[model samples]
Target: MEKISVFLDDYRKAPDGYVLAETMDECISLLYSFDIEHLSLDHDLLHKTRNGFMLVQLMIKEKLFAKRITIHSANSVGGKAMYNLLKQAQRDLILSDSTIVSLRPLPLHFFPANVMKHYLEVI
Candidate 1:
């Protein structure tokens, strides 16, 4: 099976080989439909009802996640919240072994320098 990668953001463009999901609904739909290997998220979608944080919450509730998750948002509070929630969910999944997990690291070349630096500095 072909492993997919999803990028969720309203303004930023997805890197090559990634599917762009500009809204919560689109992200959810893609998650349900694909065998996603990696997911890059951004908060503050310019909409009150839908955003990256909501997507993380929904993923936790539904027990769905990509093998690797990256929070690329510049919003400190919302980014941290999403990261924490996803980390918790990932830990739970690992403890329970309820889903298949990938141990492989993501290819870092796809990430921009600023995004990587920001994420590294935050965590």
Candidate 2:
């Protein structure tokens, strides 16, 4: 499987080395197609009805997950909701026990380069 990084956001331009998915459907397509090494999600999208939160719901319902997942929405409420749900899924054995889930409130403009490196650490 080809390991790839996915960035799901409608507005933010993904930092180098990430496959940018502007919409939930696009993100889901990538989720189904590749071995996602790292998946960073945003809660608020241009299409609120089909935002990152909804993506999280679909991911859980469909058992679609990555090796590592991060909720990087600036919206604290939505980000935490997504993060907590994923954490709960892991706890409940719904998602892979080894899959690391994190809440990182990423800025809309500045994306830390360390984040890409952070996910590459030996688990």
Best by TM-score: 2
**Which clashing pairs does model 2 show?**
none
lDDT of 1 by residue, 1-123 (tens): 567888788877776668898888999988888887777788878686688788878888886777667787767788888777766765865323333322212233365565444323211
Give the TM-score comparing model 1 with the true structure, all chains together: 0.74
Which residue pairs does candidate 1 place in steric collision?
Answer: none
Q: What lDDT is obtained when candidate 1 is compared to the true structure?
A: 0.69
CA lDDT scores, all candidates in order: 0.69, 0.88
What is candidate 2's local distance difference test score?
A: 0.88
Clashing residue pairs in all predictions, respectively, total 0, 0
lDDT of 2 by residue, 1-123 (tens): 788999898888886788999999999999999999889999999897999989999999999999899888999999999999998898989999889888978877776778656545645
